[model samples]
Structures are given as structure tokens and as C-alpha cells.
Target: MAEDLAREEPRFPPAEADVLVPLVPARREGGAHRVRFGLAYLALAAVAGAALGTTVVVLDRPGKTAGPEWSSWQPSGDRDAHPRQIADHVSQRYRRPSGTQLVAVTYAGEPQVQQVPLSAVAIQTGGDGSDSPPKFVQIENGLMYNLCGLGPSCAFPEGELSEGGLQLLRREALELALYSFKYAGADSVIALLPPNVGNQQDPDDDTSRTLFFQKRDLARELERPLRTTLLAPEQPQPAEIDPDEGLIIDRLTQPRLFQYEIRQAQEGSAFLILAPLVGG
Candidate 1:
């Protein structure tokens, strides 16, 4: 029976084989058992490779990086952060102390950026009873005057301006003088005479004295303009004195002195590339 089986199975000759193997078991299941696990593993590997390829394709799509615009662009620094930048521009034009205070302006709500150029800012002085001349001054219209105290002795009659009166006026005038100007030119100075008092000099003629603010000959030596105001015990004769703003030429014979303060908003400065203001 073994020889018959061997003959039917076609066994290899012993001289030709180190170990005789049978093909019967392999052929019994049509080779399915031999390759079943390998085929399953190959299918799994193909599925995994397809998933990885899909992920790579999705990541390589266009229009993927659209970040915020501001992420790359930064805002400027605070407008007031660099006061010296403005001061340096002013210093080039005017003789000034290093201690000059700079008033910076910016967008109302924003503190980190300048709304205007450094030259556009103006400086105002404080009337602290001191004779230090104001740093920033303006010549708008024709007159150059500051506000007066609302007291009874606000006006000074012409006759009462004696040597003592002149002394007092001079003290006040020092405060109002514009020593260091940023926006005005030396030639822009003008004189404004006090208003004539009702054209009468009668007894009890309680009228405000005529005061004048004269421009100095800055070409010779820079002189501060005269600053005058009246201090009386009663209401002003006109009831209210409007601020005079225009150029007026008159004598400052009995010049009076007054103190004044300069504020930033009240003044303006500019780094003008000044050509002729108008065309030919």
C-alpha cells in the first residue's frame, strides 16, 4: 500500500532529495491555507498606505495660510513716548534750556501713536507769578494778549500808572512776554495800543487805561513783547473786555508788564520746508 501510495503521489527518488516532502497537504486546500495570512496582511498594509497618502494630500492644499494682517505689521510707539524728538526740532530754531517741557498731542483715545507730526504741537506757559517769559507764543489776527483776572482792580487808569504802578506792571509783563517762540517769526511781532477811554478825561472818569503791547526790534536783539492788563476793584468799564486779535501799531510809552502762561493746545509748531507761502 505504501509503494502504491508513493507511486500515485509521484514521490521524488531518494537519490535526488535530501528529505522527501509531500505535496498532498498543500494541494488539499487549493493553496488557500498557505497564503491566507500573507494576503490579509497585504490588504491591511494597502489600506494603511492609502490613509497616509490621503492625509498628506489634504495637508498640501492651497489657501491654507491666511493669518491676520496685523500679525506681521506693528503699530508705532506712543506719541508722548519721545518728547525729546520734538524738543530737538524746537531747539534747532530757538535758544532753550534742556529742561523745556514738551506737550505731546495724539489721537484722543490712542496713547501709543502720534496723531500729528512732532512739529505740529504747541507749548503753553503757566502764569505762576514768576517773571519767566513764556516759551511758546502765537500771533493770531493782530493782537497778543491773555486773559485777565475777574477782579475789581483789573484795569489801571492812565493817571495812576506812576513809578510804582510801572514797577508792578513790569513784573506782570515778564510772565506774559514770549521769550521762546516755536511757530512765529521774528518779523511777525506787532504793537497793540490800549483802547481809547471814551474820549474824556473828566474827574471820576473811571475808565480802563489804554495799554499797548509793542513788538521789539528783534533784528538788533531779541526783546520780549510787552504784556499789559488792568486790575480794578469794580467791574470793567465795558463790562467785558473781548480778547484783541489783530496787528496794531501804537506807542508803548507807559509799558505795563504782566505774567502769562503758555499751553500746548494754544500754540502750534511745524517743521516747515518753507518756500514762498504762495506761487509767483
Candidate 2:
């Protein structure tokens, strides 16, 4: 499944900026390069099966970014019957083009895919609001993207993308959605991260920008040391923001994301990755 989610996550590196408080710049443009955020109404598909192994087929395609814009994102589902007659993990529902809901729920179905060794490259600052300096233009294979417009009234459609091209698509779509939360069995996965990953939340609430996720012990070896927020002391927070837990960041646009909901917890069910901002 994408080489088992890139061998269980730990590949952070795409410019890394993580700005916490340095805002006040919201622009509005009509989908030229496109920027709706909320994955523009959903339609993800995945396929792989020789004799019943990886048969992911979440329905929905024809979005944007020229038909292929995924620096990195994991989450797919589609099941009606036959895949070895389905075993576990089910709550399937897929039909949210404008709402009415029908994405039952299937995490352990078709995720855990990674192919960002480096190909969809594109780096160039001054996206289009040119003042002078802010250039890093580089699109090796080309087909790059940067759509952001949600969360705390976010935005980022001035020229296309800058801030390292939406930090390599929000750090490969938030660690490939936390490396598919133990095969999406659910039990905590919250993310809204962007702004080049690190410190952001100033007039945005939900307990300092919701991202209470946890999952890092496949063997434990990944290190970056910036996280330190269990929350206490009447927590007002923001003394140098940039210590995230699962994922939560958005300078503007690219927060057009989704994924969450699954109650029942004594010590389980907490998949709440937040980032819904890309509508009408």
C-alpha cells in the first residue's frame, strides 16, 4: 500500500517554515490555478489486486490540479461487494459532492500509498503578486499545485504557490494522513497543518487549532523535537508556536482538506484530522 505508507512514515523535508503568527493577508480569486481546499468535493480512487490484496476503489475523480495533484495524501474507500468478501473495518459511505452524506467509513481499505521520492517538483516564489524577490521556480517533471482557502479564513492563490509550494503539499498531505493510522482502524487522527508545517494559530480557536492526534510507536525512531503541548494552565498558548501533535497548520489555502469522526473511546476511536475550507 504505497510501500506500506513509505515504511511507516518519517520523511519530513520540503522547505519547512511553520509560521505560527504572522498573518493578515487574505485574497480571493476564482479558480484559475484553482483553490477550493476541501479537495474540491471528493472523488478518490485506488486499485490493486492480483488475488485479493490491495483492492482500493474509492469513487470520485475529475477534481483539479490538472487531474493529478497529490504531493501526498492517503485515504480511499469503495465497497459494495467482493474483495475477498470484506473482512473488517467498515462504515462505508461515499457521496458527498454537496452533502447528503454516504461514506460509510473504511480506513483500512486503500490508503498507505507513497511515491514522493521526487518527481512532481515545482518551486518558485512570488506566485504572482510580484514585488521582486521570492523565487525558487523548479518543476522537474511538472504538474505541481497549491490550492488553499479554508480554516481561520485561510487563503493562498496570489500566484499559484510559494512558501515552498505549500510545503510540499502540506508535508505530503500531513504525513500521508498519519501514515494511515494503523490501517485506519481509527483511534485519533487530527490534522490541519500547512503554512509549511510549524506554529500557526492566532485568532483561531478549537483549543489552539485542533490536532489532538497520537500514533508514533511502530518502533519509535523518528525525531524532530518541537512538540510540547499536553495543555494545562488555563492554556492560552502561542509563545512560539510550532510544536504540533498529529498535524495542524495553515497559512492559507491548502487547508481544503478532510477526514474524521468515529466515537467510542476508553482508549480508542479518535480519528479527527481537521481542514475543511474550500467551498462556494
Candidate 3:
């Protein structure tokens, strides 16, 4: 039986030879194509990642973008100069329309005399002494009897001034504060206008009407031509004033006044005492 089976030809169902295809050849071809596609995808991803990394590096660089408008006024002269020196520079350069110099009072109560009686006190904040860079600058100026029309010879009565006159006085004080902010790198400015004539006589007098200004608030004006911003109107009228300008004027004209005292606990240890003036 073994010999008969070996000699007999295998009889099975007949099929077309063309229809019998090997799976290995098809699989090998598909796998090769998939590997090529994967390599191309990885190459593209690498390029995209490089581009994004470059963008981030460019953006991270300093001064690549513009700063705020108010920051355009860069500090000039000796970069390492003391704050007091900077204050002195600002005072010397400042000029009024009448071509008169502004009086500058230092922290130690020493006065730098000028042609005009108008005074400016630059108070440095957040520092051990005048040598350090100030965090903020407080500029105090007086509205003298002559300026306020309060003297016997003036048209206005004592302690009285027209709305226009008051606004003019505030504008002068604000301009000085702006100069300090621009030249001294002050972040904020406190423009203190003490009661008309009394505080002028006494340097330590606490009675004051204050107008606060942040660098951001006057950014637009500072960006414009300095002459235009400082231009004195022939006759300033309330009706013709811009709304933004009006807001600042309104704040200056507020009834309330701020009072503060300077007390020195010991030599080289000075402090301030602040409170709202009652019925001011």
C-alpha cells in the first residue's frame, strides 16, 4: 500500500496559477513605502520645530519691542550720577516762559536760588539717602501771593482766585513734576501745591494741596512735542478744554487738601507724618 501511494500522482482541485499570489512580496512593498512616509514626516516636524524655536529666541531678546510712550525720555548725562545730582541737572535746565529760573530746594533744606521766587522741592522716595536712585519723585511748588492774585495790590481778594488762575497755577506745578519724571526716571510724581503764601514762608509747613500724577496718565502728552504740551494758552477757557485735560484739572481743583509733617527721630533718621487736613 505504501508503494502504491508513492507512485500515484496527487489528485486535487485545479486552480489558476496566476491567482495564487504570495503575501510576503506585497507586505514587504507596503512596509517599505510606510517607512519612507514616516521618515518624510519626521523631517518636516524637525523643520517646524526649528522655526518655532527661532521665533521664541527672537522675541526673548531685550528692546525688541517698543516700550511705553512715557519711557521714551531716556536718562541723559552720567548714568551713575546720584539722584540729587540728577535733580540739580533738571532744575538748572528748566526754564519758565518769562525766561526766569526755578528755585530748587534740596532734601536738607538748602535752597538753590534763581531769578524767580517760584520754588520746586524734589523729594526722593524709597532710599536710605540722596545717593540711591529714587523709586518716585515728589515735586512741591508754591503759589505765591503774586501768582494767586491774593496780595493787597492784586485784583482778586485774599485766598481767592479765578478758576482760570487756579488752573494755570496747577499747570505750572504739573509741568515741573513732568520734568522730574522725564529727567530723573521717576515712576510716579507727587505735585504738592501748598496753601497760597503761608507754606512758602515756612519750609516745614504741612498744609498742602496735592495733585498726583502717574507716568501712564500723561504718556500721550509726554510723547508729543514738549513745546506743544507746555504751551500756555493766551486765555485758558474751560469750555474749550479737552475732556481728558478737564479730568486732570478737576482733580487739581478738588476741595480736599493733604497735610504731612517731616519729623527727624535722630540724625540721619527722618520720617514723614501724613494725614488729610480736616475742613481743608
Candidate 4:
């Protein structure tokens, strides 16, 4: 199967990403949700945007750097960067056709752009049993989010799922969740949540159904928290606003980084055990 993916034609040019997975209800509420594994059988896999438009601010900053590994891996921070230009580039190299999902990861050398079936990651949209293919995607090992937004410059703080807002995102071992897009900003990476994961009424509300837990507990659920980011929301570039004149254009336009295209890459595996929470 891996070889088959390697042989597939390269889709859109390559691309942070955000992922939304619904936590299985402790006792079942809506209905029985079956995880789609029809990779032929492969396997798989935030918040609403209301607060996004208001004059809200993020307190956290990118202070704690994981290492040089990720410092150079994020999208370039050049002040004049335009999301459209980046999207154009990504669309050319990484975008995939129907039923196919593109995952950007580093195996041993160059960042290998592997094609996995949509069933490998997303669940059936429930409306239709057909598989919903995810657009191009790139992921990091650490938990990622925007700290604050002040005009064109948005804050993307790399942290963990220990706080109230993020703790709401925790998942069972080997379980994958999906979040719908909450807010897409010029400065912040696009926010997403499972259609049914959180409060379905609003679809973009983050404070709903929130839970808090010990930092170590979160660390335990994600055995390799820093080495893998779930595959779902595509990463955003600077100046990429969610609701704008180009809303349609941006949603379909994939994002790519000019810097990483040619450099040696160190991304983690797209499909990992994402082990169970053994202990805090």
C-alpha cells in the first residue's frame, strides 16, 4: 500500500495544519459512529469563529521553542508574505483529486509527499456514506494554535492540550476526531472542529463542552505529542483572512511554504499509534 501511494501522481504542490476528531461519548448520545477504514482499509482519524471576528486577543506567545527542528519548519515569518501567493504555490504541488488525501511528512530524507485514501483519515460526513476527501494537509508534532491577533500579524503559539480550551480536544488512544472550521484569519491558522464534535448549533464556538485536566494526563494520551499532529485542517500563511472577498478562492486554494520545498525535512509519520492514556 505504501508503494502504491509512492507511485501515485503528485497532486497539488505541497504544505501547518489543524485536526478535529470527535470524542466517543462515554455512554452514547446521538448515534453509533463508525470510523471509516476503507483505505481499502488503512485507518484513521476546534472551535467556532464568533469570538474570532470580535476584538479578541491571545495571551500566549511563541516563547517555548521545541528546538531548531520546528523553529525552521513553520511557515516563513517574513512580514510581507501574502497567503494567496503561498496558496497558489501549494495548489500547484500538493492538491489531490477526489478520494485522495495528501500528507506531507519526512521519512528519512526529503519530505515525502504520500497519497493516502480519504478513509485513512476522515469519517463519513454522516449526511452521505461516501467518504469526504480532505484537502491538502501538513502537520507538526506539537499542539498548535494562535495566541492573539493584532491586525495583519497573528500569534501562533505552539503548546499542548492541557488548558480548558484545548483540553476539550483530547481523544482516546488510536481514536481520531474532526473539527469544523471556526475562524480563518489573516494572521491565525484556520480553526476547525468536527461537524458533530462540539456544539453543533454554533459550529464555531470553542468554549462549549470544554473540559480541563492535568498537563501530564494530556501528555499521556498523546504518547508522542511532539512528534505528530493529526491530519485535518491545512496550515495557513500570513495575511490569510477567513471571511474575505477571496473566501471561496482561499478555501479551495491549498497553502505551501516556499522555504521547505527544497530543504531537508524532519516531519513525523502521518499515521501513528497515537497511543492510549496509560497514566498521568
- Please list the C-alpha lDDT of all candidates, in the order they appear: 0.28, 0.28, 0.43, 0.23
True lDDT of residue 47, candidate 1: 72
Considering TM-score, where higher is better, how would the candidates rank from best to worst?
3, 1, 2, 4
Number of clashing residue pairs, candidate 3: 0
Q: Give residue 199's lDDT in candidate 3 (0 to 100).
A: 39
Tens-digit lDDT track of model 2 for 1-280: 4453322222334654885643754445534324543343232111113212322222222345553322122334642222212211111111122332211222222211132222111122332444544222221211111222332234322333333333333433333233333234433333333232222222222121212233432113113211222111121112322444213344222433332222232343222223333310
Name the best candidate (by lDDT). 3
C-alpha lDDT of residue 46 in model 4: 8
Among the numbered candidates, top TM-score falls to 3
Candidate 2's displacement at residue 218, Å, is 16
Which RMSD values do the candidates have, in order?
Answer: 26.3, 36.4, 18.8, 35.0
TM-score of each: 0.21, 0.18, 0.35, 0.16
lDDT of 1: 0.28
- For candidate 1, write residues 3-24 as lDDT tens digits: 4222122233356657567766
Q: Kindly list the per-residue Cα lDDT of model 4 for residues 1-280, writing each as its tens digit.
A: 3342233222332323564445964444323322332331232110223233221333232457654331112234552333332323332332223222122211111112253211111111223333554332333221212122112222112221122221212221111111101111121122222112223344333321211111232333234432233222342221221233233222221111010111222343332111111111
Candidate 1 runs further than 4 Å off: 1-143, 147-150, 156-163, 178-203, 214-218, 223-280
Report how far residue 229 has shifted in candidate 4, in Å: 0.6
